[model samples]
Target: MNKKVLERHEVPVADTWDLESIFSNDEQWEQVAQQFKERVSEIDEFRGRLDESSNILFRALSKQLELEEQLGKLFTYAHMRHDQDTGNSYYAALQDQAYGLMSILEQKTAFVTPELLAMDPKVLDALVNEKDELQAFAHMFDQLKKQRDHVLSEKEEELLARAKEALLASSQAFGALNNADLEFPTIKGEDGKEVQITHGRFVSLLQSKNREVRKAAFEAVYATYESYKNTFAATLSGQVKGDIFQAQSRKYNSAREAALSETHIPLSVYDQLVETVDEHLPLLHRYVRLRKKCLEVDELHMYDLYTPIVKDVDFSVTYEEAKQKVIEAVGPLGEEYVNRLKKGFDDRWVDVQENKGKRSGAYSSGAYGTKPFILMNWQDDVDNLFTLAHEFGHSLHSDYTRSSQPYVYGDYTIFVAEVASTLNEALLHHHFIETLDDKEKKLYILNYFLEGFRGTVFRQTMFAEFEQLIHAKVEAGGSLTADELTREYYDLNVKYYGEDMVIDKEIGYEWARIPHFYYNFYVFQYATGYSAAAALSKQILEEGQPAVDRFLSFLKTGSSEYPIDMLKKAGVDMTTAEPIKQAMQLFEQTLDQMEELLEN
Candidate 1:
């Protein structure tokens, strides 16, 4: 690790984020908090009157959703602020307080959806008929009805809901330990310096040119996590048990069903992703072997994974240069997109510097009534520049969706959220390849593409698979003890890596480290989303406007329709295995090119 206490970036406390735009001061927020409590208590007034008449029911439901919208804006602002600065006790208290109130408010309106669905079928139809706004929520309403079938009596529902507050302890503990508590060993860098091992910096360090440094950092990291595996596993087992308990309690057929029911996605989509990826593992294996060949190593250990075949990305990009590079790279997106994206970046919509207590990782987050905002610790490098473009893809998608869709449907699901960001990355990668005349630079870009596919598609899929396996095991009346989860996780890593590479037993302890598994089948969507973006990137490159129109429609789409149906409008039918297969083919082609170039 090369570090002399890296100068961490500062969070923009100055004209940085207009959180005050949501609420100017603490007094205003307190007033809103009291109003939430008051309005939440008023839901009982509409108890049985939901079926009385369409107008009354519509007014009642709209009021409930309106309350939610206001609450969402308030909570979103508070949480985003707190997420950026976890150490800020004031914002943290506000977040915890807001979250508690939201929970209470959720309980107050708990009966609304179930009660509405439990009504005579004619009432729901009539309500849908009278108002288009109600029609817009038909899918959401119907989902509630679906839940009604599985729901126990109101008392039973309340009991399960209350139990959930306790069931969440393990995952919460994991988050605290991983992000805020755990520390790692320091490696003496080639430059005679030591760096603090961070979750964010670890990946870049593993890509270090020095094998000893990479090995030292990699071994040191797992060593730290390994010593604590038992605790992690216990927490992990609790997480799996929690998933199983909820799935069974809710009458879901299985853990997968419970997880996918949110998106109403077909089980085949999950099955197909696994199947397609399994069929294509050999390509990954070949890439692995070729990487070993390129490095001329006797054995490729886990530590060797990040030692780049192409040693360094020598090109340095300043903030301004990065902006221009991203702009030129995405030119195939057309002049309109180019102009709007440039304006958005330049207009202070991005918090473009890293600072103390600032959040790690990048995201585009804003409510319905604001310019889509992005936050980044924008280092002067090619990576941060592309990170900027990638997040802008998310911001622009939010901008379009918020402007076009109503509050009820403004937010898209996680399944499609990565499509825009990953597509931006793919386009930028291609743009970099085309613009560079140096072969080594071209090789560097190719290595980046390979690493990305592996990280986003291959590694995430492995995570998704392990998540499902453990959840299924628990749901099947089996206990996923710490030992069992570690064993299962290790087996999957060995299988995926094949006999060619060493799978350190310590890596099996990974199930304890990943937070995404607790998200309940959420990780698979990232793998699928990247595949979809790769497919779309090919479209935009080959058939400009028609493809652009399809993709823009996807960007504008929110939750108005099911994820699968909305994706169909964008020209890729995700329910089938086509997109995954197409992406696998691209991965193979990239590997083939990788080998030929390396040998040259």
Candidate 2:
């Protein structure tokens, strides 16, 4: 019999995250919201007085940052509460209220940037040097100055700002449709019992030892997606068009360029990732062949890629055991790091189980001044253990950055965000290998690592390529209909996995189901981040103390520097191909070991 998912309120109190840290009650949040609204009107007083003096500029900037910090707390608390149980109407209204306030705030403060741009460059520079407060925002001012060319006239900027909510409608619709409305048919489990498939459950089902179960789950998912293919295509097309509109409005040559420029990442960094990954496609193909050989299948299909080749090796890890193991895995990073991690574990920083109406998957999320909280639907398996460690990496990163930097620099960019998370996974994998004495378990670990690399580096690079292709197509006066998207996606799969494996026809609709494709060039960072983490983890394990120090420093630095510069300080230089090359080499080495173990 299939187990029933519990209601959010039915979950143990200890398993839920403590949102009370942000606000004791929604009544308190409402009071803060009213105060924030009144505070927002103060910006009107400094409207055109930015160039009068450094003190005036500093005051205006400080007020903006202050309001932002308060709003962050309010918004984070509301959204998280809503995510805990999407069916709760009260929190849903709270989230809507929070988003409405954000929109109002954006319109209210839209002129600040244009006014700052209007000031003379020399005058702005002198102001920064003259005022201590201004000096504090020197980096912010520098980044603003770089956008001088892109800053539109105040009227145009205001118009664009007002259209922000409308422009995001497509993405919002996709999320609602995907998460709330979409449903899959009940598929048979490994034990031949009917199991309802969910976004979270799909992953575990794909890894099942029973081929029949995996095939059923895969087909059920794609079949459901196929039914709504036209709707998804329309939503996806709207998203792509939105990206193009923003890029064109900002005077950027392409959507990819516009997205990368937000973090000051060079176009070459993206190009280099694709180039390097393309150069090493053979290693991925070799791994696919190895999978085919080990699984001993006549033909390896798309669904077979996920299940382990080695059978009957129980790698289940309870959440309690996972906590201690993760702390021990990260021990090389020093006592302070491990202690902070333990504090998070003990203080209820994680919401650690799936319930009915809970958001799918896991993430680390919180605002400045609140505990860096993580949400997980944890399973008793190695994957979930790594997921716990990964999210902790993000939380600890958040913890350190919030403590070290001001609210302005408290958050890191998406380009570098995955480094800490993936690094933790890599460290935990190393720990598992070293500590486990059984060869079969060791082989499973090795297989797990290779599979992760394939998914993150190889599969995501393919995704990055597809995103670029689709965006370029739309930009060149082409349509991104279901057929075009499906064909392109299928071709890429064949290219990446090679002719050795059979690319199922239903797999062509894969693009229709990817939530990331709507994310506008955001998928590439996964590949880049995985490569960087692979290199950094090797350094931490081999180079010891110095590498640990650098890795921790990287986490603490946050948005203080450009992601590229921050990563360079930690060790990897993303502009070069060395990191991706090294990661591929590691993948190859792991494959060789797995092959040897299987043979023995």
Candidate 3:
């Protein structure tokens, strides 16, 4: 394998995303940035007059959203540029400038929500009833009204809005340290050649057939983090404190409440995810035991977890093959979906390779008016193929929503964000199962599916629990010192993985590296969303067109309805534990299939 890191400019032009669609050039972006800053203050002119007439209120709302949409495009362009090459000073400055513009815009528009909340309920309702354009924002109005207690006075709101950039500093610092600054030591690859560890390549290293290489990669990565544990802890603690402060300032009982309340999700969903997944810990333990037996190892460590238990079954897929497989995987979603998916591939909506200082992991991102472009550190493997399908799920969801809904509902809350992505993964898994005939190859695919369950469902739930524990600790006046954080994280691993696996001490330092910790109660949705998608995917597979239609409708609905209600309309009620339990049942059946294959 070529271990050379390509400079951003050296990466193939076709492999890169089309950010030029957002802004033709940096100079154009600059001119628009300047014009946007000047016009942002125009929001101030309509502020005090929101309650005067329905027409006045409509204009205020329209102007704020218009400016926000423009700001989204600017910030999206700048951030994607920065992400493609974090070491680039120009893009970094552009990102910072975009953030500054956002803060200013936030301050200017801060009065709209407060002023609307200040008006009499009857008056607000009557105004909405009066204007057809205003009716499009009925959902927004309802959300604002629900958050009445949390909406501070206009001046206070503006103060918090002004602090947005500052509150984000710790997260930004962590990103800089993790993505751009810290360097991992060279480790021997499976072939005994030295390769530098990178965020993009770390997991693939762990999946090596060579145990010693996996162990070295795992320990080397953690040890590097261990040296910087104190710095990570401080940044994480600062972020937690920031989250708590924002939550408390907004009259929330806890940071989780503040985060969840945005989508009107009941806390029970989180609690039940943890509780239900805990109940299913025995299944994870059983899977771990199966993994140990399959690998014929005396002791299974965390590093051993990623290697395929079924030996010598090649599942590597090229980027082109992945594109074809992904397009085929979603064939159940109908021709239009397939055609659009093909278009995304053809249009260069995905940035498909790891380059020097590029952001790690995969994400689907774009502004309301733009194609939902994807960022991926492409590797030739099934995991990357699955990731391709997963990200395309998000992109297609964005495509459908943007095409179907108005700007007000063009995007979705994060709660439902993973559903479309994970559902695509499920369909891809199903496609593999139906097509593959060889026992060993089928075992490889099954191993991949089970590992997906382990990672997405069990692993993320563990993250959710850890996130909850740390936030609660800070809320209880506890400090998240390095030792304290590491201890709690290690303990959670022990509880989640059970006695069948050795919980490595180096794994405790794992918390220091997770970027999601900075996202304030965001990781739990992966677990919940995966569960919801499992149920929804099963429906689409079994019930045919009606289920497909319901699922497609859910995608296009966007944020027009509450997330829970949207899922309910799509035929799954996340408020209940049934979806999660249903997902676990699927996990058990898949495990059963794997065990049967091994026995044969």
Q: Judged by TM-score, which candidate is best?
A: 3
lDDT tens digits by residue: candidate 2, 521-563: 9999999999999999999999999999898888888788889
Better lDDT candidate (1, 2): 2
Candidates 1 and 2: which is better by TM-score?
2
Q: How accurate is candidate 1 locally (lDDT)?
A: 0.77
Candidate 1 residue spans exceeding 4 A from truth: 1-17, 25-27, 145-148, 160-164, 316-319, 347-359, 370-383
Residue-level lDDT of model 1, residues 389-410, one tens digit each, is: 8898888788778878888888
The C-alpha lDDT values of all candidates are: 0.77, 0.88, 0.94
Residue 309, candidate 2: Cα error in Å is 1.1
Query: Which candidate achieves the best lDDT against the true structure?
Result: 3
Stretches off by above 4 angstroms in model 3 are none
Q: What are the clashing pairs of model 2? A: none
Q: Positional deviation of 83 in candidate 1, in angstroms? A: 1.9
Q: Per-prediction count of colliding residue pairs? A: 6, 0, 0
